[model samples]
Target chain A: MGGPDYAELCQLYARYAAALDAARWDEWPEFFVEDCLYKLIPRENHERGFPLATLMFESKGMLQDRVYGIRETLFHDPYYQRHVIGAPLIHAATAERITCEANYAVLRTKLSELPTVFSLGRYIDEVVVTDGGLKFASKLVVYDNELIANSIIYPI
Target chain B: MDGAEAVFPDEMTWPAGDVGRVPFLAYTNPEFHKAELERFFYRDHWCYVGLEAEIPEPGDFIRTAVGERSVIVVRDDEGAINVVENVCAHRGVQFCRERHGNRLDQGFTCPYHQWKYTLQGDLRGVPFLRGLKRDGQVQGGMPPDFKTSDHGLNKLKVATRGGVIFASFDPDVESLEDFLGPEMLGYFDRLFDGRMLKILGYNRQRIPGNWKLMQENIKDPYHPGLLHTWFVTFGLWRADNKSELKMDAHHRHAAMISTRGQAAAAAPAEVTQVSSFKASMQLNDARFLDIVPEPWWKGPTAVMMTLFPSVILQQQVNSVSTRHIQPRGHGAFDFVWTHFGFEDDDEAMTQRRLRQANLFGPAGFVSADDGEVIELSQMGFEQKPFHRTVAELGGRDAADSDHMITETLIRGMYGYWRKVMGL
Candidate 1:
């Protein structure tokens, strides 16, 4: 509402990054609407019109399942990921919906090792003003790098 | 069992010629790695390069590598597929720099100097053949004896099966059918039935471990239920399932098949005691684990087929992909994963495949666990290069077995490696 308050949107983006960086994955689904689309895709695939994505979730329920599996069922090395998000550029906005893009990077720190840049990408988002507040309806992360080091256990 | 006596000696020697015992030096020795590339990759092996669907139109092409040598697979004006070395004949620079492109018009032109080649890799023109200033003058030009035909890019023997493309440097290698025996051929056909394939995307991962470790991880059927807890906790794979390690005659290739619904009525005590297998763990959205069965595949719900030295064809539930293993060095390698789906798949089927993609890429739920384990195994050899990894799980020989609990496939792969390396 009111031409998508730019400052408010930036604050929302900051909170999203904080949640992921802190490993509070259980609270991740709360940032999205009930029927949302979340995908992590390579820039090459997006340019070539390929449908495959590194991580794809059609609904908030699927996103929650991923969080649950990684926290409980899956076994991965212990590591922490810190996300640094840049200012959002609002492309279009209305009373009901908003479109925005932002540059982001993630650094991974394992045990006593120094932090290293794990991934860098642009988040292309479609947001809507729901009853609860502004929430993401679709988030497409298009990573620029082609080579992934070892495995990406945490979401970037 | 004697950890004290397992010291790596300076002179690598295999006292017993047993498949159960493999020298750790094989994974850490750079000299051995170079020799293996020469004997196996450069000479006799049929390496998987790309898919036919990638270059459907004439002039469409994709560049790949064999060992360290660059190669390009392109379709000519005559609609014939050709595999040629990517090196330019003039200055030896890599001609095709882009990963994939369409050379519809004049063909590929070297950016370094103006050497040109047709889509079939035939030398066509140079910057100034006769002269720089005048057309028919013999100034600053090649000799009259110079022949463009002799300067074409080096070509390889090419073959196709079930839409998959493979190439070999050896001009007289056996047919692709005979190379993949009757058993392995059946599995290949089942996964790549003549149906049109659609490119989903790719996941290129650089692992800090030997390339052989990646191949061994796929071949070893014993680790799935143990190392990847997600497989067991979610009931995707069980030790009680009907599974087997099918190998070619010379033990160069193998296919590991495991079918669902064949889980034993009661898992053995040892299986139940495994810390990873927790029947209580369940998923909130079980659709991610759903299986949309294909009519062509009637045998197993999952299959990991390896073509020796490098490629792996994998089907984990509904997600299908081809992994091209490229060795960077003795301690590093690149796993190029090409994910795909059938062209005729409906919207729901396509979404199912896309959703199930989380099961095996570098960040895959099932695959993420492997990169670390393989790296740790490689690190173990740093201190004891002479120490041998004990592979005596099922037996001392490399043979096929109906049971899933075995390292026979790993032994079988090494059996072929030893012969090729002349170790």
Candidate 2:
């Protein structure tokens, strides 16, 4: 991958994060593949073979439903989030589709300048170069920090 | 049974039959609640500490507070569980200080002096004690008059039902069966029913309200039709006007019990939240609107029995819970909610329960409203200790009368309060 494709992919990843951390949440669905699978399963349940999840979203529709559910059904103090995504590491690339990974550290400052390292996770992404160049075909975020401050109200 | 309907003494007359005119000081006075903790919680009744599932591995220990003291619940190498004081026996330092962990280094080491003890809290080793001894005449090193037993962690009376473990400072409390009371024990037996619990997660809230009031809020059906109409608007539960709320002889506890009704039961009040909720969500899943997860729970006969003085055994439609409301004082309560599913429940069913979980806690739709209202109520009760609130929801007289969604049970709890405090 050269400058044009590589730079374009990084920008897409950045937008995906921005739409999330910036609370431009509705824009999140566009970042995912229509048939995307997203999940935030706890390690405790994983080890115990429990099927329950802190969050379990099967499709982009379910993920959309999550955002809608949080907005209407949940009551949380208003807060802001900012995501900083690093350059992408292209794992395997083809002309039409590219598999890449990037490290992300999201700094969430709620109501003040005292920003907290909300979550640090590595994003494993599969990108497709379609008419919409370098859109995420699949993004599986493996969050390093357990015990989120509250919950992931929006996609990362 | 209909404690709330009991008449309270007015300026006109004296009331009778263990029903009227109980003082509200128990909610505001730290002194009375403390004595009650000693007499009931510490002396003769067991307190719920933590579930057994919390510490399954050898050397696993978790710190929990029961009433006012910090207690360490540990699982030994032999898989035997013990409830001991969290305080270090030697200098009274906290032994297992962290919330939870595996202390496999030949027992627990106090962070202060590095003194070590077994999971059973026996003196495993005292750091540098033998080396500090002069000429094998261990004079002041081990306190020549000191018996190791004297320094071991003080233990509390403990019992378990299902995976739930309960302990008490009370030396002569009745058995777990008798302690829970027949009505409560029967409901608990049905809820837990000897099933191993798979903890989904824990959510904690430090509500600024009297712990007793927090329990009353849960048992009060009076609020649901008005405050939590969101659930009814979504068609989640139908509160039976025929249903009754009651409490035991000791009014320190409460039960919001609603009997399962046939589909043919007469209509009571029109569901309240129909217009308030976003009509869109009600349009999406009408099943979410009506179908409940727990088969035993028909039309959502959710009963939250606050086991007095503290633990609340909840039987919701999908999520079964045991919330240990550790009262910080007369003013605040630290609530630790443990959500569960039967170990035998299938993956799909478990998922359904977790999804249904959306309706609770602070993030939860149904729970967030109560959470806010309770905190406000706590704030209002102040500056007006003499001014009072009424518990009369379903009219007067006993025998569990009138509307099911009444403050009848709350009144019963206060009656029990007067008995315990001899007020």
Candidate 3:
């Protein structure tokens, strides 16, 4: 295939954000390939090569497990999260994969209070073109701020 | 006086030294928080600062807090570790601002006035001592009566046990091993078995609750099966498992240990059959839940050990971590979690620990509910400060237990808290 369309890849990012913002958690794993990695790590850990991540999923199956657990087992305060995704900065594009970076801010509204910026981070993604268009082979959500307020129950 | 009479009449008070009865005011009162910082933190307790592995080389330093005072733990030229106040003696400004760094040849230089100090916290030089600038221009300087030797950074008593460092403001405080007690020391040594630690990462969480609540959470072994349904629903923890609450002789330190028994593996099916335990979930990658047993640890599968004032050594399933509780105020505290692994861990072993990380950090499936519950408990105090929380699960006394369903450890922690705070 020819070089993946940058506009189409940006649209894929928009779709992923909307799914999470809508709390359509069941659809989250569909954004990634069958064998993929998704990790939400602090920038300090990312820079220092620390092995731990706040949220680490080595495969799409693990991502599905997280969604299932959060929906079924875990109990957290009732809150709604809205993810604002910025434009993607495409680094390299090929027939098989594409590397891109995008900035994001998550605003959470709980108990009808004002929406607060819960977390701000940049998404470093490795995208692949499959039968379903662009799917993330690897996505690293590196949060800029280290101090997490209360807990991060929902995905960022 | 009637039984309902106020304990202290005017000021806030504890009702008859009952470990089960914890007044909500203790968590919300500002006066109590101040007293705790003075009596429990500064005067009496040995607070865990950092790991010796963090500053292995000379001049390597990491800044931390002992209650509210900023402290710096550095390695001197001769490889001895020193703990000193981060405040500059000249102007009382914080000198070492970074969280951690290497100052190999050059010693700590005050960022504000260019005052210099050796790694051992001795006053080395002042930039313009005799009012002579770098260009040899004479200007105003310190008064002649000011002695440079007496103005060195204030040092604290430092101690290391199994590579973990602890510092105390009071030099006369008990030795590290004695403070931890023999029982706790054994478990502490088991956790930190002299293996070089590789910092996996950190999950720093700011909870809107009293610091004691965090400690109590670790001490209360009864809450896991009830509060965190993920543990029960996923067969990771069971109420009928072989678990116990072990306290030190003074009841100041405690460890809640849970071993995975054969019966524990079957508990999920039995629990899920009941309406309360039924939850719609299944792990696609169940390998993450597998516990690759460490050869050294012959104890329980899970252990949450509390070191009195502010440190917690935890081995939840396969994840090993230390939590440093920094009290922000009466109503809030920060849980600085340092996740670690043995330096000799193979690739698969490291990945297993990293994969299991989802089980217990700030955003962890099992740990996420704790922050919420603690915050909710803190919020409850705003409406009812005079109300008391009942910790009468296993009677009022604080002692060791053979069962997981007990509040003995929580009471033991508060018992220690009451003694240290002189309540």
The model with the greatest lDDT is 3
Please give the range of 10 consecutive residues that has the lowest summed lDDT in model 2 chain A: A39-48
Native contacts, share recovered per candidate: 0.77, 0.06, 0.87
Error of 1 at B47 (Å): 0.1
lDDT (Cα, 0-100) at B223 in candidate 3 = 84
Candidate 2 lDDT score relative to the true structure: 0.65
- Ranked by TM-score, the better of candidates 1 and 2 is 1
**DockQ (0 to 1) for model 1:** 0.72
Error of 3 at A63 (Å): 0.8
lDDT, residue B398, model 1: 84
Worst 10 residues of 1 chain B by lDDT: B261-270
Best by DockQ: 3
Clash count per candidate: 1, 9, 0
User: Each candidate's chain B TM-score?
Assistant: 0.95, 0.85, 0.93
Per-residue lDDT over B1-423 for candidate 3, one digit per residue giving the tens place of the 0 to 100 score: 323655333466677678888888789889999999988789767998988878888989989888878899999888999999999998999978898888879889998888999888889898767776666676777788877899899999998877788999998898888888899888898889888987788888899999989889998878888778777777777777888788888897899888876623446555334345754446788867867888867968888899878889989867988999899989998888888888889888888888888888889988989999999999887667767798999798888999977899888878877777777
To one decimal place, how large is model 1's interface RMSD in Å?
1.5
Better of 2 and 3 by lDDT: 3
- Report the lDDT of model 2 for residue A52: 43
